[model samples]
Target: MATAQAAAGRTFTTDIPARLDRLPWSRWHWSIVIGLGTVWILDGLEVTVVGNIASRLSEPGSGLPISSGQVTGTAAALYVAGACVGALFWGRLTDRHGRKKLFMITLAVYLAATALTAVSFSAWWFFLFRFLTGFGIGGEYAAINSAIDELIPSSYRGRVDLVINGSFWIGAVGGSLLSIVALNTDLLPENVGWRLTFALGVVLGLVILLVRRSVPESPRWLLIRGRDREAEEIVASIEQKIEAEKGEPLPEPAGELVIRQRESTSFAEIAHTVFSAYRRRAVLGFSLFVGQAFLYNAITFGFGTILIKFYDIPAGDTGYYFAVIAAGNFVGPLLLGKLFDTVGRRVMISSTYLLSGVLLFGTAWLFSRGSLSAVTLTACWCVVLFFASAGASSAYLTVSEIFPMETRAMSIAFFYALGTAVGGISGPLVFADLTGSGVVGDTVLAFQIGAGLMCAAGLVAAFLAVKAERRSLEDIATPLSVEKAPTAEAVTE
Candidate 1:
């Protein structure tokens, strides 16, 4: 998302042609974000489905040993590893083979693997399926993001992108809801409840696929590949729609779309494009990836588990607490999600980290004392989740915006994968390591550490990042060229 972004933004005047309504979602551009946003939701769901059902997985006679907790956690790690690898393959593939085709591939891999995971009989089988599913997920960092970045208008990009990005929480809720009902039932064996949790992932994926199918090929990719005819066809459709809305001829396409050094770019060539060219992006992008993975992964994967086990919530009603926790998850991103756009990315990020850390510290105090009312505890926790999601959600879209088109996909694939390898892979282990030997081991202290990390990262990022009013996605991407960048990519929806 970071490396290959363009130095451009789409210009949309209120002069929206009346024909705008006639264009299908796919043709409009922002639809790409919507499409990928849905993918992010489903993939995120697959990643956590097993964790949400860890209680059931740990049940006796479920064919797993008492070590099922670690077993599933390890599987989550491996899934992230697969995503790291998959991103390497798919990011470039999208650039080379075109975003549309590779988008299809990632979607299918995730959708199919999710369904298969639902039926696995052994830990190894489950592990293998998750690992494979991670590959498709890896591509998502680039494919949907790149498609969306290239499609949407810049002014609306941050907010719209963040909102679409909010689907991850929506998926998180979906996973929790399924686990809540299915984990409590015998519609499948207790062992099979986890499977049903994963199998249920297919429904969202299918929806993503259907919506994505309506979205058209990337005009940017088409033009770059020298498929000018197809590119023009898409452009013509866009122009025709714009003209119709105006009841007149559309204004000339203003920005110059250049296809430089037309050779097929190898992985090394693609990588060199960033590390060799832009060091500022290298540091910023890596930070975004690592920070997000470290903080967000811990919160999502550990939140429900810790809420039930360490907090002493009864198992029968664990789902209810988990739901409360998930609601906290949704509540965070839903209301404050747009902070990235209105408040400026740096302010929002810094505020998110600082406030969330304070919330965590407060939570730590509450857990240590063990004297807080239930309502107080839940309210405080939910506040933390709100900032957490708002800040964290911005990371994904922000990462996508920071780099140029040439290295956008590659940079995103590299750092997100790197972050996943570092933070995403390590987060659960860190939680598992907490031991909670202290009074608030799993409950308050653990979350404090997580929130503190976000605060720290945000502080560093804020000081280093461009000020909010001055921030624009295109400005940071593609520094090698002396020529001025056009604008940030357009939003389609």
Candidate 2:
């Protein structure tokens, strides 16, 4: 590896980005996926457990004295608020410091907060802990998404990210099954079982923390920070590992990015980049995020309530139905993720969003007419979310890809914060109230609103989506600080 120190405020060139993009998929990449992608699973588990146990928490002998609506609405809203704040706070640090530092710290915060949640005895205590847990998971989103994009080969980025994001349903499935046991009087006492459910998340987070220790910082991020020597060495190490695993020499890396080395990017610069220069992309990201956030948050947080309140399904049986729904969510991304990289981003994103919206409208009509049983309604939900999950996962992929390298983490944070604030915070509260009404018409109205927002977002995507399939992140959006742009010939290579 070679070394170079930039003169103050001067520019330098490096092939680190190209070197990273050219490597073959190997265990090196799988380790990164396991270490970072598991956060989604943890988040899914947290959300599903709470939703499935809402009735348990609201019972008279349960430790908390809150109503089911309070448990799902107020607590869910506070968790989202914490996630919004955490995204901004940790997002800036992720871009400024480094991907490795913030991801590790954020995961540690999540583990601690979730552990505390298991011991909560009152509504306020539970709310505070849930907020803290959301705070940690929120930070993980900014840091992890940025790192994964920077490290993975562009050809694999779309499917890799979508599948990882969709893994939340893996946790959702686990949570649903776990709740069935936890809520079972024969297996565990009510209060004890609910507390144990939260503790399970802490255990999972701890295991991931150990795996993350082996993952390295983003070499592209290191180069931009003026640590050219470290960046070169890390890339070299990764290439060597990949070659060894493949038992053959790797192809030579092509292309070059010349950038002005900067110690840090200011929040003002990140904001200006999003709002002024890349304004249309900002709009696209916000629309995609807000739509999916509202729909997912509403359904995931309050689905159990709808089952119990509207269809007279017992609380214990909700988990069985939820497990089926979660399987559909997981299968959508697993099956459709490859198409995002092959079929292109614009068409797939729009089609999934529009189709899901159309399906939700059909679901609303059936429910309003009282024409569906609990099993039939659950089946309807599975089909609707199958398309919606893929669309929702693509939203994260869109924000992460359509921004400059320097602001990637913050871009994710900005849109995630704004979208969550608008949709995530309100979705649960609105659904909780509507579901509590126990009137099919009321819940039907809520479904229509969600369907409308999703359809509107799809239209926005069809107009503004970036055609970024199988392209390097640099090609999608040039780094803000690139000193000498790549020539036409180099770009084509």
Candidate 3:
């Protein structure tokens, strides 16, 4: 490998992007997926355990003196609040400091916060740690999504991203099953069971952190920051390992990107580039994220309350129902993910959002008429979320891929924070109160609101989603670090 020449305002051309995207799928790529992607599973477990345990936590013998409404509503909102703030805070750092460093730091933050949460002696203590835990997970979203998109080959980016994001439901499924064991008073005491869940999350996060240490920083990110020689070395190392695996020399890289390297991008520049330069995309991102956040928060946070209040199901039994829907959520992305790459982002995103919305409306109607049992209702949710999960997972993929490389982490953080703040914080509060009222009409109305927003987002995606599938990051949006002068391969639009 040749050394990258540099000047005061460093500018250079390198084939790092092409070198990464052109490599064949190998064990190394799987390592990246397992290392970075498993965090979502942990996230899913954290959320699902909280939801399933809301009833248990509200009981008299439970460790904390909190109501089911407070557990599901206030605590849930605080977690989201933490995530919103954390996404923006750590997201900025990820863009400035580099993906590898921020991801590792964020995971450590999560582990420590979760450990504290497991030892909470009061409601406030639990609430504070919930917020802190979300803070770490929120940073993981911006950092991991940016890294995954940068590292994965363009041909596989869409499906891989969808599966990774959807992996949150895998944790949800585990949480559901785990809650059954933990919440069984016959098996474990009430106070002890709830605390055990958080401890388990810390354990899983530790394993992910160990694997994540080996994952390299994004070469694209390194080159843009004037660390060209390090970037080349990383890519060269991967190529050698891959060729040895394939027993053949790799094909020549296709193109090069010339970057005027900078250590940091100002928030002002990132904001202008996203909202001003790509105004339509900005709207699309907000709509998609808000829609999914509201829909997921409404259902995930309130599933236990709804089952107990409306269906007379035992608190311990809710997990079985939730586990079914969680499976549906994961299956949606695994099944429909390929279409986003092959059939295109516009069709898959719009169709999944619209289809899921329609199904949810049907569920609301059936429930209003008292025409569904607990089993049937869970089935309905399973079907609706099958499509919704794919659409929601696609939302992350859209924001991460459609922005300039220089602003990737910040753009993801900005939209995720904005959308999640609006939808996530408010969704649980609203749903908790509505479902707690025990009025079928109130619950039905809540369902209608979530369904409406999802449909609206789908319509926005139909018109605004970019044709970003199977394209290099630079092709979708020009990097801010690129030279002002025209390059033969520079993507204008």
lDDT of each: 0.63, 0.89, 0.91
User: Where is model 2 poorest over a 10-residue stretch in terms of lDDT?
Assistant: 484-493
Candidate 3: where is the Cα deviation over 4 Å?
1-8, 484-493
For candidate 3, lDDT tens digit of each residue in 422-441?
89998888888887789999
- Weakest 10 consecutive residues, lDDT, candidate 3? 484-493
Candidate 2 lDDT, 125-221, residue by residue in tens: 9999889988998899999999999999988999999999999999999999999988997889877998999888988888999999988999888
Which one is best on lDDT? 3
Q: Rank candidates, TM-score, best first.
A: 3, 2, 1
Report the Cα lDDT for candidate 2.
Answer: 0.89
**TM-score for each of the candidates:** 0.84, 0.97, 0.97
Instruction: Give the better candidate number (1 or 2) by lDDT.
Output: 2
Candidate 1: RMSD to truth:
6.0
Evaluation by TM-score, superior candidate among 1 and 3? 3
Better of 1 and 2 by TM-score: 2
